[model samples]
Target: MTDEMNNAQEWQARAESAEAALSRVQAEVDARLIRAELKAEALRAGMVDLDGLKLLDTEDLRLTEAGDVADAPALLARLKRAKPWLFGVAMSSSSAANPPRPEPPRTRHANDLSHEEWLAARAVLLRRR
Candidate 1:
């Protein structure tokens, strides 16, 4: 009976140890996944350095997790407000994916005048004649 009790206690201890180890692994995995998500968001917002992006506070973490982050500009602005040091350097943003087509150059000649202007000028010339 005594041996059986000791064996049961040992089994219980091992089980508790395993449970603790599993919980730790789970926490680590969750933390990594959160970092990955934030990194992805940062990259989408044109942030170059994944290392530079750190979840600021519990509210920030919750906001990211809840998918309540703002658009790219607002997100960048919020991050700048939170971590001004991170934005201290001049980070280069990519040019718009497709820049608007350049307007075609005007084809009108330098002396080109509107119809009204031309008519008025002709009237003045006739008066001079």
Candidate 2:
């Protein structure tokens, strides 16, 4: 009877140890998740525009290889002072507005042309406008 009680006590101690280890692991995971959530919230709050295309620093203005004005805020401020129309385009394409969608292909009548002809027609259509 004493031996059985000792074995049961040993098992209970092992179970408690495992539970404590699991709790420690869970706490670490929870902390990491909380940090990640906070970072995401900070980014969202600090976001000046949607695509993150505009930088927080405005003084660094230059044209990128992709032709986008690099120092967007300064460029925007300049445009606001100079050309409102150009500024509007920049603002519309920035994170503050939904991105411009590519224009859909113009459809041609299937009955008027064969498949190969339609493909060739589409290529010509795409090039023309």
On lDDT, the candidate that comes out on top is: 1
lDDT of 1: 0.65
Cα lDDT of model 2 by residue, 52-85, tens digit: 3232233333445663444444434543455333
Please list all clashing residue pairs in model 2, or write none if there are none: 50-95
Q: Residues 25-108, candidate 1, lDDT per residue (tens digit)?
A: 976766666566666766666565556664444233433455444343465568867666654456458755666799998775
TM-score of 1: 0.49
Q: After superposing candidate 2, which stretches have Cα over 4 Å from the reference?
A: 47-129
Candidate 1 ranges beyond 4 A from true positions? 55-77, 81-129
